[model samples]
Target: MMNWRSAPLAPATASQTASSEHADERIKLSDEQVAAAQIKLAPVETTQLAEHFLATGTIVPDADRIGRVAVRVLGTVTELRKRVGDPVEKDAVVAVLESRELSEVKSEFLAARLTNDLQQTLAARYKMLWESRSYPENEYLKSRLTAQDARIRLDSARQKLLALGLNEAEIEELPNLPIEELRKQSLRSPIKGRIAERRVDLGALVGREGQESELFVIVNLDTVWIDLAISPTDLSKVAENASINVTAGPDGPNGVAKIIFVSPLIDKDTRSAKVTASLDNAESKWRPGMFVTAEIPVPGRGAVLAVPKAAVQTIEGAPTLFVREGQEFVARKVQLGHEDDNQQEIVAGVNAGEVIAVSNTFTLKAELGKSEAEH
Candidate 1:
């Protein structure tokens, strides 16, 4: 065993000479106490502590990939194929609505088309007869005007069906559709995503004038938005497309993500700017609404004196480290600098190559506090 009884004390000023000696007194631990205290020690040394800024945020749905499914026609929902959490395909059918109003529109379209066809034939015949001098010019002109009006009415009726979600193929086939099929409108999803919400039920009355009834909300989870709040002091430290490591609880990141968006508007209440990061959630590890921590590495000023975070102890509101000399653990005041996840840089009152307590520092503080009370 090494001897510390003969070791000389550190030099101090007139005001601190007495207090410093008291603070630097040794912590005498029996072999059993040392084992029970779980003391760990490491040399006070410089370490390359890459700087990082921590910000909190939550995973949210990417706006570009989210879609709200709604119906335009006045109808009653007859069938719902997908429920919440179901995976869907692009242009997939989400639900079916039965509407008498739609059926009436189809009937008007069929009637208008027949009228247009009849008028067209009459106008052609009148033109031929007028060229042959077998019909009057005024009769031909009147027939031509009738044909044009019928054609306009036919186009208007077709457009009304189109606005109700019928494609060109379905519009073309509508004239021949059976009465039952003509009234059934299938609500289709516009994009590929998972069903996030279901707002309609079977036999539910839906669709109103000047408004659309939302049936399902689909969201693509392949990519998710990380909604982060950056404080005013840290706003400049983070920027668009900066590399980030997101973590769950205290663990390391599940995967790397990049800052995609940063809001210019600062929140009045929190005094923080909104920032966003896009992460690949193909494996679905980072799910929406899950709170996470984002660690962004910023440029460091330069190297400085540093040590493991565990080496520092809070004794009477001051940061202190227990230095080891010849088996003696002495409390030493320390000044700290830039810190990150792994290390804390020591600015003053500690020198390189000195052994300091790295773990179980609370035990040393408690022991020192008891001795100080006794004195």
Candidate 2:
């Protein structure tokens, strides 16, 4: 709340006298009084005034930030490291499974590795003997070819292990692990996020026919999407990369979201285009399924003469603005045009580069009313 102080109307200036037609509507006050009344002034300028339409939307997790934790091999859930709502990091192991299918692959890799090692040793010895003429050239050649074949098999087996989700470090450690642990494999998250859903329990059989393939679903809520349905009439006004203001509800999270997607096809039943906006939610104040309202801005005519919405006051039911002329302020009736939340287009009665009272125009209106009463 602001305290309003009344000031005596000063003598009219030459410009005010020139505009004698509006002399009665002018209110005068000293610089000290203007400062005390908290009346701020700004230059009227040319800017775009966009029209807006409201659309209902819902908050949801960003699809690109979602992660699924699953395994490729047939396995039994032996351990669950995370539950619903637990935070997880990228590549973090969230669970472990025991799979005979995985054990068979590991065994093949180990056998190929051992055979390649033995063949390489034998090939090297045959080379040395051949160099000294102690071994036959044909025998040395046979040994060398066998080693080459063994190397190719070893590479193939290693690739199979990689396809089954074993990392380089895990495959290297396979030969050192005891035989009993050969069947164990870990499930890791592909993204840093929180566990949104846990579909498996300990001892549950997964990765089989008619069984759940995903063990957990993780979502990063640092950013979220507000899905909106735009009517066909306003779809032309909306475009990708534009911004919309969104409010979850009364007393709920509110933010300006960037339009990321605008569907080309409209729904047959609703006749509305699906639009989506990306909003930063680092605070995590918003959640999925929360209903929100979005204010989409319709493209406006290029730059036009405009003033701040605050500068326009309703005097006796008509929109008015106080233009600062010389040392006094004069109430000028103006014609209004397209307007958005902050700016109102002035189709008439105002010109660019003229300084006018912008904030606290109500005080000037009060002073004008008082002057009228005095007259």
Candidate 3:
């Protein structure tokens, strides 16, 4: 560390010497001394300083990212492939159900398929005989019509299987499955997530009237929502798409998030409006129901003279900043107006285009304290 000492200056005039003895707020440091002391300077410029409002919120899973595995047909849960908190992929089979209703549909499809094949064979034979004049045209027409009706029935059966949650591939492969497995249907997750809730146990009957049809609740924690409660007084400062910083306890920073929603109506009991923000949780660091603090930037009044946060120092209970006047640095008491995380608005005691010490102002404060002690 470089040692900090007051730099010497040339002799002052009579009035200057008398003024220096009166207040003695100035500390003179040479160019090399300033550089060695690591003192940096910045111009007091006009900037839009956004004041922030504090609000509390809880982390929750994004509503759109949550998925549910539910059954449509009456069935008994035969197997569960995933338990609560288990990770799952999109379209992953999470559970299996055995249902007599599904078996009947599968059987109907098989019957229709067999009849269609038989009718098609007979229709081909009848067409050959009709072309050879061995069979009447009317008989051949009836045979072809029967083949068409069989095809229609097969299509209807296929549709029924689809409505019962069978995909095209599954329905196409139905004939190859054994008889015992015919009643079994696999339930797949609609999204890639972790299972949040499991509502059914093995052998539990689902899809019955007045019974729970849902099997598992899966949530994608890649992104989450922070529901904030904004009071009525600070509601005007909040706007959609505004950015904010979120922190969960003392576990470092959770990064920035954008405001996605703000409610127009305030809650009567809480006397606050609801605001929502979306935070990226791809690391799985944040979870639902975790309490977090959010810092929201309030709208700035306009551009005003401002200085870096480091430039301001507290001396004798007054906010002080060191302003460069010619070759000397003078401490001036400043009246602060509004401030954000980076800047503090200088409402008085400073002007635009004025140079001030922006870094290591505490060194200047120490020197000022030392000078007063000498007197």
Q: Best by lDDT, which number?
A: 2
Model 2 Cα lDDT, one tens digit per residue, 1-375: 222345554546447567667555777666776777778989999987777999999999999999998778888998999999999999999999999999999999999999999999999999999999999999999999999999999999999999988889999999999999999998889999999999988998888552878889999999999889998998999989998889978899898899999999999998898999999999988899999999998887799999989999999898999998766888899999888889999999988999899999987887777766656
TM-scores across all candidates? 0.64, 0.77, 0.80
Span of 10 residues, lowest total lDDT, candidate 3 = 5-14
Evaluated with TM-score, which candidate comes out highest? 3
Full-model lDDT, candidate 2: 0.89
Which parts of model 2 have CA positions greater than 4 angstroms off?
1-43, 48-54, 131-134, 236-245, 295-301, 313-333, 353-375
For all predictions, the C-alpha RMSD in Å is 7.9, 4.8, 4.1
- What are the Cα lDDT values of the candidates? 0.82, 0.89, 0.88
Q: How does candidate 1 fare on TM-score?
A: 0.64
Candidate 3: what lDDT?
0.88
Model 3 regions lying over 4 Å from their true place? 1-14, 17-39, 115-152, 209-211, 299-302, 314-318, 359-375
